[model samples]
Structure formats: structure tokens, C-alpha cells
Target chain A: MSWLLALPFFIPITTALIAFLARGRKHLCSVISITGCFAALCVSIAIVTLVVSGGPQAAQMGDWQAPYGITLIADRLSAVMLLISAIVGLCVALFAISDINENRVKLGFHCFFQLLLAGVSGSFVTGDLFNLYVWFEVMLIASFALLVLGGEKIQLDGGIKYVALNLVSTLLMLTSIGLLYGLTGTLNMAQLHISLAEVDNPVAISTLAVIFICAFGIKAAIFPLFFWLPASYHVPPVAVTAVFAGLLTKVGVYALIRTFTLIFPNDLGFTQNILLGAALLTMLTGVLGAAAQYEFRKILSFHIISQIGFLILGLALNSPLALAGTVFYMIHNIVAKTNLFLISGTAQRLAGSYELNEIGGLYKASPLLSTFFFIAAFSLAGFPPLSGFWAKLLLVKASLDQTAYFVTAVALITGALTLFSMSKIWAEAFWKPHPQGHCKSLYSLSVAERLQRLLPVSLLASITLILGFMPEPFIEYALGTAGELLHPDDYLEAVLTGSSH
Target chain B: MNSIILQTATRVLVALILVFSVYMLLRGHNYPGGGFIAGLIAASAFALFAMAWGMEAAQSALRIPPGNLAVSGVALAGLSGLMAIFYGDGPFSGQWLTLIGAKEEDGIVISNVLFFDIGVYLTVLGAVLTLIFALEEAS
Candidate 1:
């Protein structure tokens, strides 16, 4: 049974190995990777179903009891995250087959890709705080390789800044983990909860809490620390950047939500107010930054920062509805943002450049691609009857309930500005005539390439539509997950239980 | 710098270091020696070989690319964890088999833990050598 929890990451590890061994066989590697990801997706869905029906499940590594051994726990929050991650992982792996070139495949792209997925899955499922740190390092190393794999001048430039800043964040996280360990002699998150409460130093706790906020905040790309994201995200290939955009920062957000809710429950008045202020600035800066960018992917990268503000707002509000909103928003944002990146990649291929001024006639050439870009873009802008709209509605209502009118106002205005940015891209990239006077339409591509690229975008776009149309079940799930996050009793009980179940 | 005396000494030293690294790896289960230090020690021996005999000699000595070795190491490590599934235990759960059974703790015990340690040893050694070899070849 415990093996079930380990399979999500293990499948990726094995796939990476097989793919590495089948080095020159690109088709075989792609087949191995996609099948492995598909299998992991199935496992993730199974875990979610089990968690939803049977409550949280915890598996102790090597049959050792918790608080002494590594633990993998699957509660509603983790289960939902695992499911979304699997969906994104499978989609990205499929997209990479045709999108990535032969040179990259020969250079171990598929191996590192699987390793990155393994890291993401590991981070979501591990119940040990120290283990989470290890997973973060795994993700960092894999992503670093993916970023600079091509060894282009621009990639190296971007990789340097990305590595430098992320390393600083890693340093901060380690320091705080050390401090926490000193405060409580345990690293297990479930036991940390009890041990932290026993800590007599309120000041030390708050200080450590602030340090954690900064550490995770950097990772999440919140306001002041987000420059690295826009600088580097546009450097990688579209498939690589898509996964980075969708999952990497979200891991940071997940860490924030986990720590703020579980470890630093005290000093809310101080910590939360700081978070609230940061959220507003992050939202304002991200949208304004997006507005300034004329390149396609650059704009989307900035918007990621803006969207992170909304997820943080949910945490800042600290309401059940607000938390649920963040949960829903995370799923929505991951799909929408990834689809937009994939669209930008397709647009880059279609028009031969990522510059907004250079790329145009996409709508005239292929309405299907334009339609996808429109759905994903507008959905990101929180248009009604879309998934982002429901996400916005929940946060807005939550803010109003708390009588935080300023936050509500910022939320609405950010939505309007997000729409403006989306329209700017639409008008420039899609509606405008091509500067070169001619461009290949999507239909001009071979069927295989089109199928490889379009299939993932179409599938993800349909998910956004489905979530928008029938959000009842998803909302219920998010709400239930939020309840579990707020009250981690089930999580703690499962982790602290003596035997593996 | 390309002295015959240095090359001869390196050849002898490399063999000694390789043997000692394996001892360190095996002794790690119960003593201070472990996979990481053993791997580093092994890598240093190859580094010395590279310095003495030139890049081509070091490359041929390894016989496989360090990247391939690293991948195989990771595969071995992962498979070691999967061994526990046959025993209905968690991933990486240690399953011990005593060769001469009769009394508890009186025989040579073979376990998945040792396999895991060996995996880690190879992974570190391969990864470290890959980076150094690439840099050396480039230069």
C-alpha cells in the first residue's frame, strides 16, 4: 500500500533511466516518457480518489514510525496537487516529443524532464520538511539543466541570474530549517506542529516565520523577488518554460500555504498583514510589467507574478472561502498559464519570431490556434463563465466579508488590467498583419507536428472550458481541500499513526 | 609536467585508491565510511589518472561516458528501493538475508541497504567525473 505513494516519483525515475538508455532512439524515448507520465497520472488520480473517499493516507519509509523516519502523506491538498501535476506532466511530455529538437533529445532532455517531474511529485507528497528541501534541490538541478541545455548566449545569461537568485532563496530556506530544527528537534512536519507549539520563544518563532516568508516568497516570485522569473522564463524552450511556469513557482506557493497555515499559525496579525501588503504590490507590479513587455512569452511571465498575488491573497485572507479560492485559482492558473506558453510557442513557430511586432496573421492563417489563444488568455484575465472568473469571485467575496474593500478593489482592477494585457497580445500578435508580409499557417505544418503541439493545448483549453462550465464539483473539491488545510487534524493523525496504512 | 616518474606513480596510486574506495563503500554500513566519501575518493583517483595520462587515457580507462554511468547509477539506486515491494514493505525498506542462519546477527547479511549505498556511490562518482571530464576535454 505504501508503494502506491512512491510510484508517482518512481515511475518518472525509471522512465528517465529507460529513456536515457535508449538515448539515440527519440521515438522510443518519447514513448517511454509519455507512457510513464500517463501511468503516474493514473496513480495520482487514484490517490486523489482514495483521499477524497477515505481521508488522508500516510506511508512511512522503510517501515519506520513517523517523527523518526521519512514519510509520504496524501491528504486532500496533496492529492489534488498530485492530480494537477500529473495532468500537466503528461501534457508537457506529449508536447515535448515534436516541440523539442533532435539535438536536445540526444542531450538527455527527456531524462532531465522526467527528473523534474519526479522532483515536483516528490515535493507534493513528502511529509518531511527536510525531504521537501531535498526535492526542491532536485527540481533546481533539473531545471537548471533544462534552462541552459542549448548553451545559447541568452540562455546562459538567463541561467546565471536564475541560478544566483534561486541559490539565495535556497540558502534562506536552509537557515530557517536549521533554526526550526534547533527549536524543535524533529523535522517531520506533523510532529513539528506539536513541537513548535511547545517552543517558548515567540520572538524566535516570528523571526523564523518572517525568514520563511522571504524564502518561499522568493520561490513563489512574489513582488520584490520576482525579477528572476521574467528574466529567465522566456529563455527556455516553450515546453520547458511551460512546465517551469506552471509548476516551479507553484511549489513555492504550496510551501507558503503549507507553512503559513501549519507552522506559523501564530502572529497572524503581523505576518498576514505583511502578506496582504505584498499581495497587492505583487498584483500591481506584475500586471504593469506585463503591460510593458512587447514580446509574447515575456508578457505571460510577468502575468505569472500577478496571478501569484491572487493565490497569496487567499492565504493572506486566511478564510475558508479565501483558501478555497486559492486552491481553485492554482489549478486554473496552472492550466491557463501553461496553455498560453504553449500557444506562444506555436505562435513563435508560425510567424518565425516571438516578438509581438514580428508575429501576426495567426488568426487569418489558422482560426483554431487563435481560438485557443483567446480562450486561454481571456480565461487568465478572469472573464466570466470561465474558470478564472469563479476563482476571482471567491476571493472577492472573501475580501468583502472581511470588509477589506481595498483588497477587493485591487482584485477587480487587476482583472481589468489582465484583460487589457491579453487584448494587447491579441491585437498585436493575432489580429495585426504580418510584418514580413507572409507567414506559414498552422495548417502548413505536418500533421504530426500539428497534432503534437495542438493536442496538448486543445486538451488543456477544454479543461479550462469544462472547469468554467461545470465548476460545482471542482469547487466542492477545492472547498473540501481547503477545510483539510485549515484543520490538519486528519493530516497530523495520519502522519503520527504508528503503522503504515 | 609530463614526467614518466609522475605517470608511473599515478598508475600505482590509482589502483590503490580504487581498492580503498570499494573498502570504504562496503564498510559504510556499520562504520564511519560511506557512499559519498567513497565516491569522492574514487573520483579523485580518476582525476589523478586524467592529470597523468591525458584526457584520452582517462576516457578509455573509464570505458563508458560518465553520463551513462550516472544514469545507470540512478537506475540501480531506484531499483534497490523497488526491491522492498516484493516483501510488501515501503520503498527503500531494508530486506535482510542472512547467509549462515541459526543465530540472530551471526552471519554475513546481504541487504538492499548495501545495494542502495553502492548506487549512491556510483551516482556521485559518475556525476563528479562527468563534470570534471567535460571541463578537461573542453580545455
Candidate 2:
């Protein structure tokens, strides 16, 4: 159980080394990578079990204690996050197995993908803030490689913007870490909590808070800082874009929630309201951006920015209910976003073009693919009886509890716009008639057509449906996780106390 | 660019760069000679080395992957903080034992906090190196 958290860290890296050495052995490499993913899943499950059964676990690396040696602690929230990352990772691994091979059997793709997984899984589980920064760099570097895996013209353009923006964010984050250490004389997350709990310099504290927010905001694709996301994410392959859209931005949001609730609690007055306004604007603008897009993946990319706003809104509300909502919303978004992007890939694969103007009436051509796409679309739009609806409900309820009528109204309106954008994809691709002149341009599929495409799509779509129908486990975990995050004394104690480690 | 002139010039430049980086690093304890400066200075040494030699040659001299350097640096820095556990000084506790130097916070505060600076230096060097290498390789 103690070693479970380390599994996610070690497996991807080892597989990456193996894949790197095996260069041309694509099949073997993919198999090994999938097994690594499986191990991560099993490890995550054990972590949850240990957290629930044993209450929580923290241990210092190399027998050194906290605020000193590095600690990898698993509290309720970390475990829950670990579990969700694993589940989503498993789906992505499956999708990538064929996706990477089919797209192009390049060494860079597999090597970078494994590295990317390692970064995400490690970020989700690590206890130290500095380690979190390093892990984020790991993820960012790998993602930079992944984004440009094809070395396409558009990808390079997008990659340039992505790298520049994120590099700046990392600089901000590092500078803030240094200043924070200079101010409070500590870097351990828990230690900082105790160290700065009553530091009286409001000006200094708020400045650091703003720095942290701007740094994370760029990553989370928040209101004014989000121009890079839709522009960049739209250019990658559906598989790449889906994973990026699903998991990457949320890492920023997760950092925000962790830092705000735990370390930067001194100046919630102005900070909370500004963040709240940003959240509302992020959602409204994102959906409107989605409304204007005619491309399949671009709209989904825009919604990713929008939905992230909903998640952050929960954190801004700062109540336990809102925290729970944030957690629930994040889980839903990851699965739903990934599934929708894969569907887009599958759609593009079958229909031959991504432009909805030319690629209409896919339903008539491939009913199974269309059905899967519809399920994912409905989830993205937060339709009733879908998991997205529940996540959205939690957010609305959380906002209402705080009596933030304006935010609630903005969320509700954005939900409608979300539905509208999704319906356009549904209408343009599934209902509208294909162009008679370009009929000959459509791609031909053989007997194994549905088998090749439907399995990946159906698996992801079913996971979304299952979560929607039976959200009890996820909700319970989210509640526990949110409670632990909002009141992180246990997390603080875990790192600072020798026995806690 | 014969092998002799290149090798001798590169070696001297590298030596000079390393000395400069160390100066920046240690001096940063009180002034600007902290981890960030140190890391950059060390990385600049390597960058100079790469410029004089080739990427492959310079990387070979590194004796380990840049990524490992980053991880180890982070670990070393973090290890310093965790040192408090053994002393019961609480997390990130500072131990202000006297050293050979005078009672200045600059030299040998005998604190775990100083230990973290070393970690930061290595991490910065390794991270920058990794990025430069990746970018060069990508291009």
C-alpha cells in the first residue's frame, strides 16, 4: 500500500525507457505501455483502499521527515484524485493503443505519451509543492513534445504559443515559490500553512496570491488568460486534443484549489470575488466561443475552457458543498471531454473531413459511430440522466447556497449555450445532408469498420453512462476529498510531523 | 576549429564558466547568489560547453541524464527540509548552530533551509538543461 503511489510514478517512466529502446517494435511497446497503465489502475485502487481502511497514509522518502526530506502523502483527496486519474488514464491508454499506432508508429509519440502520463499521475499524487512544480514541468515538457508529435505546420504554430505561455507561467510559479520561501521560510505545503497562518503583511500576501493565481490561471485557461487554449488545442489530433482538453487544464485548477484553500487563505475578500467573476466570464465567453466554431474539435476545445470555469466556481464559493461540486465536476469533465474528443477522431476517421459543412449526415453512414458521438455530446451539454448534468447541478446548488445569484444565472445561461454548441455538432454531422458534389470524397471503410472504431468509442461512452447512472461512489469520494482539501490540517500535520510522515 | 584549439579553448572557457557559476551561487546566500542564479550559472557552463563541443559530447560528459539531475536536485533540496524530522525541530525547522565563521546568517547557519538552496540550484540547472536539450533535439 505504501508503494502504490510510487507505482504511477515509476511505471510510465520504465515503459518509456523500454519503448525508447525498442524503437521499431510498436506492437510490443504498446502492449508493455498498456500493462503499465493497468498497474497504475491497480495501484490507485490500493491507494483508495488504504486511505479508506487505514484513514490516511504519509511517509517520507528515505526515512527523512517532513519540511525537510520530501514526503509523498496520501490523504482522502489525493487518493480520490489518484483514482480518477487512473480510470481516465486507462481509457486514454486503450484509446492510444490503436490511436498512436494507427496515427503513426513514431517513437516520439509513445515515449512522450508515457512521459506525459507519468507527469499527470505524479502531479496528482505528490505531497510537496516544489515537487508539484517539477512534476508539472515533466507534464509540460512531455505535452510540448506530444503536441508537435506530427510536426505538422499548424501544430508547430500552436505549439509555439503553448510553450511560450506555459513557460511564462512556470517562471511565475517558480518566482512565487522563491518569494513565498523568502517570506515564510518554508516550502512544504503543510509547513507553509502553519508558517504563514498569521503573517500580518496583507499587501505582501495578496501580491503572492495574485502571482499564484495568474500562474495557475494561464494553465487552467481562465477568463482573460485563456486565449492560448482554444487556439492551441484546436490544432492537435482528436486523441491528443482530447487528453489535453480533459486532464491538462484541470491540473492547474487542482493546484489553484490546493493552494487557495490551504496556503493563501488570508485574503479571500477581494481574491474570491475577482476569481468568481473570472469564473463566470470564463464560462460565458467559452460557450459563446464554442457557439461560433464550425469545426468539430475547436468547439469541444472551447467547451473545455467553459466547463473549467464551472469547476473553479466551486472553489471560489469555498464552501464544502462547492468543493464537492468542484471535485464532482472535474471527474465528469475529464471522462466526458476525453470521450467527446475521441468521438471526434472516430468521426473524422469515418467521414473524411472535420469541417461540419462538408462532413454532414455521418449518421446515415455510420450509425454506431454517430450513436457514440451523440452520447458524448449529450454529456458535454449536461443533458439530464448524464454525469455532466449531475456535476453541473452540484455547481448550481453550491452557487445558490452562497446566494451568488449572478454567477448562478451565468452558469445556467452558459449551460444553454453549451447545449446549443453541442447541438450544432449533432445537427451539422448527424442530421444535415452531405454535399452531393463531394460525395465521392468520403472515405471508404471495410468489414471491420465498426469493430475498429466502435469498441473504443463504446467503452468510453459506457463509462460516462455508468457514472451518470451510479454516481454514488464518485460523489462519496468527492465529498471526502473536498472535506479534506477545505480543512487540510490533517494534510498539514502529515507533512510536518515525523510520525505523520 | 581544429581539435587542439577547440579542446583547449573549450576546456578553459568551461573552467572559467564553472568558477563564475560557483561564485554567483555561493555569493547568493546573502545577496543575489542563491539557487536560481547558481542553477543558471551552472547551466550556462554546460551551454558554453555544448557550444564549444557538440550536444552528444557535452551530454556524454554529463554522466547522467538531465532529467535525473533535476530529480536529484529536487530530492536533495527537499531532503534538507525533511532533516527536521530527526531533530524534532518541526517541519522545515532551522537549526542555528555556530560555525567557523562569525555570527552571520550568510555562512553556515547550520540550517536545513540552506540545504534546500543546494537542491534548488541543481534543479534549476537540470531543468534548464533538459529544456535546452529537448528544444535543440526537437528543432
Candidate 3:
């Protein structure tokens, strides 16, 4: 059971080593990376199955008991996150084969990519706060490398802003961890949950909660702290940006959810209002920012911020339904967002530019590619019978049930604005005549390059469609996860009492 | 750096520091000296060597790319943890074996922990050297 829990992260690290060793041979390295991601996906699926059948599972490292050594626990939430992230990792790896150049491959792109996956998986499964911090640093270092892999002037410029702001967040996190440990004398999350409840100092606890909000808020790019995201996300190769878009900020949201629900569930009155305001503002600012962008990836990057607002909105509502909404929305956003970035990459390939004014005629050149774009873009914009629609429906319903009419209004307005941005991209890039008078079609790409690019996009789009069509099981699973989160007795027992269900 | 006196002193100091690093690694399980500290000490010795004899001479002496060495070290560390699985324990559970003497208490007892430490040692050494070498070459 422990091996099953550990394999999702362990496989990626091992793959990273092999891929690094094989970096000189590009084909072998890519093959190793793709296989590694597939193996991780398979392991995560197994974990999800185990967690569903048996309940939460926990494993202690080095044979040490929990609250003493590192524990890896997989509840329904962790299992689902691991599964989705692994899927994203595999898709990005496949896309990278054609998207990445030879120079970057030799520079160990596959190594860092696998390491990032390992960090993300480790973050999802870790049952310790310090362990989560370690995983965050692992993720940060790998992402920084990936962000500036080519050392383009633009990449370097963006990487610095990304790193500089993130480092501040890291510092705040460390300080908060230190304060929490000094107050509670434990870094183990389950143990902290118990110990913190006994601490009578509400003021200090509230202060610590605010600190956590600021730290994680920066990472989540909520409202005022989101400038770094749009500045940096559009600078990388589309494959790198695609993976970052799918998994990175979502990890921040996952952390915020984990810490707030598991560790600070009793302090909701204090954090909820703050989160609600941030969520609404984040959605408004993000959609408005997207409305102002003409660059393809830049627009997508800003939309990531807006969608984060919705995820946070679900968290702020803090009902079982709202939390379920958060989970579903996250999964939907990761798929649709990643697929959109990938489609943008393919669009750039065909139209020869990411600037809306510089490229056009994609719909006429390749109707298949245009269809793929419509599915991903419209899904992102919350069209009916699509994944984003269900995700938005859940949140809107959650807000309405809470009688939070303001949040519901903001959410609906944001969704419409998001549609406006998507249509702007469609009209300029796909519908209009090509500025250069000739647009390269998907057929222009070699058979292998075309397969390497389109397969991931199509698979992701199908996933969106499937989720749209059959959200029942997934919604039920999410509600179950929300129930477990609201009452973390099983998680506590699994970690603290050294038991696995 | 070109001084004969300094180079002679470095030659002796390098060997001594390396020996001490290994000693630190071996004694780490029961003592404060551990793989991380020992690895830093070993890396410092090489950094000194690179300073005294230049990076080329240091590279020839190491005879392996630092990047490859670092990656292999990580693999070794991970494999050491996975070793517990063969014994039907958890992923990182320590597996012990008595290498010599009559009993586990009296003999030279070793465990997967030592291998894990050694892996950390190699990883830190290789990673630090890789950074230092790149910086030196760039400058």
C-alpha cells in the first residue's frame, strides 16, 4: 500500500535520473519521459481505486510512526489530484516532443520536467506541513529552471519577476510555519490539527491564518498579487507554459484548501470574508485583463487567474457543495486550460504568430484544428454541454444556495466576459483573413509532428466532453471528498493512529 | 593561485579533507556528522582544487560529468529506499544486516540508511561541483 502511494512521486524522480542520463540522445530521453509520466498516471489511477474502495491510505517513511516521520496520505482529494496532474504531465510530455527543440533537450529539459511532476505529486500526497514546503521548493526550483530554460531575453525578464515574487511567498510561508510550530510544537498536519484546537489564543491563530492566506494567495495569484502571473506565463515555450498552466497555480489552490480545511476549519468566520472578497476581485480583474490582451498566450494566462478566482470562490463558500464545486472546477480548468495553451501552440505553428493582428485564416486552413480550438475555448468560456459549464453551474448553484447573490453575480459576469475574450481570439485568429495572405494548415506539419501535437489536445478535449456529459460520478466523488474534508477524522486517524482504511 | 607554496599546501589539504569527509559520512548514523555536511566538505575540497589547479585539471581528476553523477546519486538514494520493499516492509523502512561477528549487537551492523546517506553524499558533492564548475567556467 505504501509502495502504491509512493510510486506516483517515486517514478517521476527515477525517470528524471534516467532521462538526464539519456539527455544526449533526444529520442531516448523523450521516450523515457513519456513512459515515466504514463507509469505515474497508472499508479495514480491505482491509488484512486484503492482510496475509493478502502478509504484514505497513509504510509510512514523509514518505518517511523506518523507525526514523527514523513507520512504520505491519499484521500479521495489527493488521489484525484494525483490522477489529474499525472494526466497533465503525460500530455505535456507528449506535446514537448515536437514543441521543444534539440538544444533545450540537451540542456536537461526532460529531467526538470520529471522533477516538477515529482514535486507536484509529492505536494499532493504529503501529510506533513514541512514536507509540503519541501515539495513547494522542489517545484519552485524546477519551474524556475523550466521558465528560463532557453534564457531568451523575455524569458529571463519574466523568470526574475516570477522568482522574486515567489521567493517572498516562500519566506512568508517559512515564517508562518515557524510561528505555527512554535505555537503547537509540531509540523505534522494531523498532529497540528489536534494541538491547534487546544491552543486558546485566537488572536495569534488568526494572525497565523492571515499569514497563510497572504503566502498562498500570492501563489494562487488572487486579486492584487496576480501581476507576476500574466507577465511570466506567456514567455515560455507553449509546452512548458501548458504544464505550468495546468498544475502550478492549482497546487497553490490545493495547498490553500488543504491547510484551511484540515488545519484551520474552526477559523472559517475569520478567513471566509477575506477569501470571498479576494475571489470576486480576482475574477473581475482577471477577466478584465484578458479582455485587454491581444496576444494569444497572454490572454490564456490571464484567464488562468480568472478561473483561480472561481476555485477560490468555491473555497470561500466553504459548504460541502461549494467545496465539491471547487474540486470539479479545478479538474475542469486544468484540462481546458492546458488544452487551450496547446491549441494556441498549434495555432502559432500554422499562423506563424501569437499576436492576433499578425495571424488569421486558421478556420479555413484546418477545420479540424478550428474544431479543436472551439471545444477547448468554448469549454473554457463555460458554454452549455461542456465541462466548464458544469463547473460553473456547480459554483453558481453553491453560491445561490448560500444566498450569496453578489458572488453569484460576479461569477456569471466573469463567465460572460471570459466568453468575450474567447470570441475575440476566434474572430481575429481563426475567422479573419490571414494578414500574410497564406496560412499554414495542420497538414503542413509532418505526420509525426502533427500526431505529437494534436493527440494530447484531442485527448484533453474528449475528457472535457466526457466530464460534461457524465459529471454524475465525478460530482458524487467530489461531494464525498468534500464531506471527508469537512470532517477530517479519517485523515487524522490514518495519519495519527498509524491505520489505513 | 600560481604560488608553489599554495599548491603544495592544497595537495595535502585536499587529501586530508576528503578522508575526513568519508569519516564524517561513516560516523553520521550515531553522531552529528552526516551525509549532507560530509558532502559539503568534500565539495569544498574540490572547489579548492578547482581554484588551485583550474577546472580542467579538476574535471580530469573527477572523470565524470557532475550532472550525470548528481542524477545517478539521486537514483541510488531512491533505490536504497525502495530496497525495503524486497523485505516486505514499507517503501523506506530500514533493512539491517549484520556484516560480521556472532550477533547483530556485536557485529558490524549496517542498514539501508547508510546507502541512503551515501547517495545523499554523492548527490550533494556532484551538484555543488556542477554549480561551481559552471560559474568558474563562465567567469
Candidate 4:
């Protein structure tokens, strides 16, 4: 059982080792990477199935009992997140075959990529707070390497900002963890849940909660701290950007959700207002930033911030339905956002630049690519019968149910602004005639390159479509997850009462 | 660097530091020293060697790319964890072997924890050297 839980990250670490050793051989390294991601995806699916059937699963490392040793626990939330992230990881690995150049591959791109996935999976499944911090560092290092892989002037500039701010966040997170551990005498999250409830220091707990929000907020790119995201995300290779766009911030948001729900479930009166205010500002500033962007990937990067706002808003609302909305929105955003970055890469490949005004005629050169862009972009904009629409609907309904009219207004306005930005990209990048009088068609790409690039984009777009068209099962699953989160008795039981031996 | 005294002293110092590092690593599980500090000690030896002789000389002395060595160390540590699974225990559970005695506690006790520690030793040694070498070369 523990091995099953461990495989999602374990396989990736092993793959990273092999891929690094095989770095001199491009094809073999990519094959190993893809196979590793596929295996992780399979493990994730098995874990999800097991969690669904068996309630929740927990494992103690080194046979140490809970509250003492490291524990890895997976409820519905962790399992589903693991599954979705694995899918994104595999898709990005497929796309990297063509998108990454030989120089980068020789620099051990596959190894770092797998390591990044391993970190992400570890972050999702670990049941210890300090373990989460370790996973975050793993992610930080791997992502820093990926961001600055080429060491281009632009990339280095971006990487410095990214690393600088993230390090501050890390320091704050570590401090907060230390404070919490001192207060509760436990680093295990489930144990903390029980220990915290017994404590009466409301002021200290509230302070720690705010510090946590600041730490994770920086990572989630919530308003004020989001500058690093746009500055850095656009500078990486599209495959790198795509995976970062898909999984990284969501991990931050996931941490926010987990900590808020599991350890700090009460204290709503204090934390709720702060989270709500941050969420509103995050949505507004992010969309406005996107509106001002004329670059392809930059616009998408800003939207990621805006979307993170909605996820946090769900957590702030603190209803079961609202948390469910957060889950649904996260999945929707990961698929749609990743797909958009990938399509931007394809669009750049076709039209020669990522600057909006410099490229056009995508619709004329290849309607198929344009259609893919439209599906992903409009889905991001909350078009009805699309995934984003349902995700927004859930949040909107959840907000209205709570009589949070102001929150609903901000959410809807942000949705409209998001649509405006997507249409801007459409008008400038896709719908117009080429400024240079020529745009390359998809047919110009070699068949292998075409397959490598387009297949992931198409698969992600189809996932967006599936979630939009058939959201019943996913919505139900999310509701169940929210129930578990709201009442963490089962999670606590799984982690604390389960036999370590 | 051109001083013969510094180079000659480094030759003797590197060997001593390395042996001490191994000693620290071996006594780590029950004592104050462990893989991490031992690794730092060993890496400083190479750093001193690099400073005295230069990066290429240190690289040759190491006999493997630090990056590869670091990766293999991680693989070794991970594989050590997997050993517990084969013994019908959870991943990372310590498994012990008595190589020299009849009783469990009376023998020369060895455990997977030692392997795990060794793995950590190699990883830190390699990683620190990788950084130090890069910095030295860059400068």
C-alpha cells in the first residue's frame, strides 16, 4: 500500500537519474522520460481508485508511528490532484520532444523535468508539514534550473526575480512552520489538526495563519506578489512554461487549501475576511494586467493569476460547495492554461513571433490550430458549455448561496474581463491577416514534430471539452472531496490510527 | 597557487580530511556525526585540492562527474528504501543484518540505514563539489 503511494514520486526520481545518465542520447532520454511519466500517471490512477474505494490511505515512512515519523496520506483531494498533475506531466514530456532543443537536452532537461514532477507529486501526497516544505524546495530548485536552463539574458533576468521572491516566501514558510511546531509540538499535519484544536492562543494561531497566507500567497501569485510570475513564465521554453503554468502555482494553491481546511478549519471569522479581500484584489489586478499585455504567453500568465484568485475565493467562502468549486476550478485551469501555453508555442512556430501584433493568419494557414486555440482560450474565458463556464458557475452559485454579492460581482466582472483579454489575443494573433504577408501552415512541420507538439495540445483541449460537456462525475467527486476536507475525521483516522507496521 | 608549500600541504591534508569524513559517516547513526557533515568535510577536501591544483586536477582525482555521482547517490538512497518493501515492510523501514555474531545485538550490526547514510554522503559530496568547481572555474 505504501509502495503504491510512493510510486508516483519514486518513479520520477528514478527516471530523473536514468535520464540524466542518458542525457547524451536525446531520443533515449525522452523515451525514458515519457515512459516514466506514463508510469506515474498509471500509479496515480491506481491510487485514485484505491482512495475512492477504501476511503483514504496513509503510510508511515521507516515504520515510525504517526506524530513521530513522516506520513504520506491521500484522500480524494490528494489522489485527484496526483492524477491530474501526472497527466499534465506526461503531456508536457510528450510535447518537449519537439519543443526543446538539443543544447537544452544535453544540459539534462529531462532530468530536471522529471525531478520537478517528483517534487510536485511529493508535495501533494506528503502528510507532514516539514515534508511539504522539503517538497517545495525540491520544486523550487528544479523549476529554477528549468527556468534558467539556457541562461539567456532574458531567462537569467527572469530567473533572478523568480528565485529571489520565492526564497523570501520559503523563508517565511519555514518560520511559520517552526512557530507552528513550537506551539503544537508536532509537524505531522493530522497531529497538528488535533493539537491545534486543543490550544487556546487565538492571537498566535491567527498570526501564523496570516504568515502562511503570505508565504503561499507569494507562490500562488495572489496580487502584490504576482510580478515574478509574468516576468519569468514568458521567458522559458514553451514546454517548460506549459508545465510550470499547469502545476506550479496550483501546488501553492493546493497548499493553501490543505492547510486552511485541515489545520485551521475554525477561525473563519478572522481568516475568511483576509482571504476574501485578497481573492477579490487578485482577480481584478490579474485580469487588468492581462488586458495590458500584448505578448502571447504573458497574457496567459496573467490569467493564471486571475484564475488563482477564483480558487482562493472558493476557499475563502468556506462552504463545502465552494471548496468543491475550488477543486473543479483548479482542474479546469490546469488543463486549459497548459493547453493555451502550448497553443501559443504552436502559434509562434507558425507565425514567427510571440508578440501579438507581429503574428497573424493562423486561421487562414490552419484552421485546426486556430480551432484548438479557440477551444482552450474561450474555455479559459468561461464560455458556456465549456469547462471554464461550469467552473465559474459553481463558484458563482456558491458565492450567491452565501449572500456574498460583492464576491459574486467581482467574479463575474473578472470573467468578462478575462473574455475580453482572450478576444484580444484572438483578434491580434489569430483572426487577423499576417502583417508580414505570410504564415506557415501546420503542414510545414515534419510529421513527427507535428505529432509531438499537437498531440498534447489536442489531448488537453479534449480534456477541457470533456470536463465542460460531462462535468457530472467530476463535480460529484469534487463534492465528495469537499466533504472530506470539511470534516477531516476520516483523514485524521487514516493517518493517526492506521497501524504503522 | 604557485607555491610548492601549499600544494604539498594540500596533498597531505586532503587524505586526512577524507579519512576523517569516512569516520564521521560510519559513526553517524548512533553518534553526533552523520552523512551530511561528512560530505561537507570531503567536499572541502576537493575544494582545497581544486584551489591548490585547479578544477581539472580535482575532477580527475574524483574520477567521476560530480553531477553523475550526485544522481547515482540519489538512486542508491531511493533503492535502499525499496529494500524494505522486499522484506515485507514499508518503504524506508530499516532492515538489519548481523554479519559477525549469533545474537541480534551482539554482532557487527549493519542496517539499510547505513546504506542510506552512505547515499546521502555521496550526494552531498558530489553536489557541493559540483557547485564549488563551477564557481572556481567561473572565477
Interface RMSD of 3: 0.9
Off by over 4 Å in 3: B103-105
lDDT of 4 at A211: 95
Candidate with maximal lDDT: 4
lDDT of 1 by residue, A1-501 (tens): 698999888888888888888869889989998998999999999999899999999999888899999999988888888888889988898899878888888888999999999999999999999999999999899999999998889999999999999999999999999999999999999899888988899899989999999999999999898989999999989999999999999999999998988787766898999899999999999999999999999999999999999999999999999999999999999999999999999999989999998888888988999999989999999998999999999999999999999999999999999999999999998899999888788888999999999999999999999989999999999999889888999888999976485
Q: Write the per-residue lDDT of candidate 2 for residues A182-266, one digit (tens) a residue.
A: 8998787888888887687888899999999999999999998998898799786666787788789999998998889888876
Highest-scoring model, DockQ: 4
Give the per-residue lDDT digits (tens) of candidate 4, residues A236-260.
9999999999999999999999999
**Candidate 2, overall lDDT?**
0.79
Error of 3 at A266 (Å): 0.8
Which scores better on DockQ, 1 or 2? Answer: 1
Q: Give the whole-model CA lDDT for all candidates, comma-separated.
A: 0.92, 0.79, 0.93, 0.94
Second chain alone, TM-score for each candidate:
0.94, 0.81, 0.95, 0.95
- Give the CAPRI class of candidate 3: high
Candidates by DockQ, descending order: 4, 1, 3, 2
Candidate 1's displacement at residue B87, Å, is 1.4
Output the better candidate (1/4) by DockQ: 4
What digit string (tens of lDDT, one per residue) describes model 3 on residues A407-496? 999999999999999999999999999988999988889999999999999999999999999999999999999999999999998999
Q: List, in order, the clash count of every candidate structure.
A: 0, 6, 0, 0
* Candidate 3: residue A261 lDDT (0-100): 93
TM-score of chain B of 2: 0.81
